[model samples]
Target: MCRWLAYSGTPILLDELLYKTEHSLIDQSMHSKLGVETTNGDGVGVGWYEAGEQPVPALFRGIGPAWGDVNLRELARVTRSGLFLAHIRASTGTPVQQTNCHPFRYGRWLWCHNGAIHEFRELRRDLMMAIDPDLFPSISGSTDSEVMFYLALTFGLREEPVRAVERMAGFVEQVAKAHGVAEPMQMTVGTTDGDRVWAFRYSSVGKSRTLFYSTELNALRTMHPELEVLRGLSEETRLIVSEPLGELKGAWQPVPESSYGVIQKGADELGSFTPR
Candidate 1:
């Protein structure tokens, strides 16, 4: 229903990813070849953490088409970050408002999702009720995406991201089955706490939204040695997105179905994932 990208690597201008590629996030906002919706104009948001600053990210969001925003254009051109997330939303039943935008933030954590809870109206109340009471009051939006973030927080995302997401998914399935919904969840979610990023791709029925992460920077450089930019970036740099930002051969790799991966300093790890 939407498209998003998470980048962790060398510090670089946001525009490099948001605007410069053959199929940048801005271009994807208007013409997404992989998403269910060709145009995702409901809203847009970007969250980034400055090096040496607090782990919490800075955010800029607007309830307007990203392609038409002068402010977004200016911000993207000037802001540089080592870690950042940008999302373009196409509302899936929820009202199109700033609060409903992706890249929801809580403390030092930032999160974004590109899919939804199937039959959300039938499952919303139960899902909300399952969130920890202390955390419920902080939920400021009505989208299932935001609720799912809080659910992960309740399940202990701060300490065990993979397991926490598993618990959240299991909880949703439990509630959905009780309410007679055959398929309860669908998601390609990305989350981070300034240091590492964890991305998950899964659904109750096996088919899920598209998600891919860039290949190792060293490999990409060797494959495309003419691309000077790739050589300048850190070997630790990585990007995970709903689709490839460019068509460079061997630049992207699919995140396997029903699994999750972590992008960190050393070798990135991809492992099998299930709801429970």
Candidate 2:
């Protein structure tokens, strides 16, 4: 339902992934080839933690298409971070408002999601009631995407992201099944606390939303030998996106269904899970 990306390697201007590529996030905002929609105009956001910052990531969001937002263009051109999260939304039923945008922030954690809570209207109240009251008030958006974040927080994302997410997914599947809905969740999530980024490609069904991570820099460089920028970035530099940035074969690899990817400096690891 949306397109997103997370970078956890060399720090570069946001535009390098958000706008400059042959099929960057900006391009996917209006011309997505692998999304349900060609144009994702509801809203967009970006969050990045510069080195030395207190894990509280800086975020900028707007309820406008990415291509027409001059401010986002300017921000992308100037900002750089080793880890970045950017999303272009296609709101399933939520209103187009800045607060409803992705890259939602809370303390040191930043999160973004690219799918929906199936038949959300049926479980909105139930899910809301389940969020910790203290954290519930912090939720500023009406999107299920944000609620999912809060749910993960309730399950202990701050202290244990992997377990928290699995618990949250299990709870969601439980609630959905009670309403006679099967596979009521679909999501490709990116979350970080400045030091490491954890991304999940999952759904209640065996099949999940689209998510891909870049091949190792050394390997990708071998394929496109002329792309000079690859040489400057560290071998640890990696990118995870909702879709391939270009027709660059061997440049990206699909995150296996129902799996979570942990991107840390110098190494990438994946953990498999069954969402309830």
Candidate 3:
């Protein structure tokens, strides 16, 4: 599995989340405490939206570890965004190339996944065929993560992200069953369309990978009144991650297994989610 973080809040510098945290995504790349793999050096990517600009999010990905990428450091230090996603890839069974990196984009949407489709080789063909023909041509990598992203798109992600993802998981299970694979899915995904961000955590057996979201900014500020940055952020500021960025008590909460949530300007909602 990989490690990722999604930020939806004030227009702060990328490094504020990517580098300054106690266990930042960059730090997780070399020493992850919750992921299946300790090192996620296959590749890394970042996608962010510029406020007041077009809906599309810009991307920067490389076939190198996030901890050692000078370009990533430079970009994170200067670039600022209200909504952004960053991922460090640990390929399950795919090549370490830029094309296979996370934060896959489709028009206004950007997506990243931290878990894999068990025995993807057995389900890839069937899953690929289910994608809409028009969307099929846009797939550029062989990873199940990208395929899952496109599958969500085919199922109406642009119109209904949570429902589309539920359908995508159901479809994966259906295809895997036909191929004789019982345990077919595991995922902790984050996606956005430059405005609202949606995150999901689920698996076939109910023990999904780790996922957490930061406490509401106002609450965090009240908890740690000395932290100036927390006070400067908007009340709607939020973060979803594969793991907690730090050990700030009351600052992070685990996303329940088999659940999904939405993070937006002022419409945050968390509810039960299951395949279909």
Q: Which 10 consecutive positions of candidate 2 have the poorest summed lDDT?
A: 267-276
> Candidate 1 lDDT, tens digit per residue, 50-90?
99977779999999999998999999999999999999999
Each prediction's TM-score versus the true structure: 0.99, 0.96, 0.98
lDDT of 3 by residue, 1-276 (tens): 799999988899999889999999999999999999999999999999998888778999999988999999999999999899999999898999989998999999999999999899878988999999999999999999999999999999999899999999999999988888997899999999887899999999889999999998777877899888786788888999999999988999999989999997666999888788
Instruction: Estimate every model's Cα lDDT from 0 to 1.
Output: 0.94, 0.89, 0.93
Pick by lDDT: 2 or 3, better one = 3
Q: Which stretches of candidate 2 lie over 4 Å from their true place?
A: none
Which 10 successive residues of model 3 have the least lDDT summed?
227-236
Q: Could you give candidate 2's per-residue lDDT for residues 98-191 as a string of tens digits?
A: 9999999999899999888899989888888999999988999898989999999999998989889999988988888888888798988999
Clashes (candidate 3): 0
Cα misplacement distance, residue 80 of candidate 3 (Å): 0.7
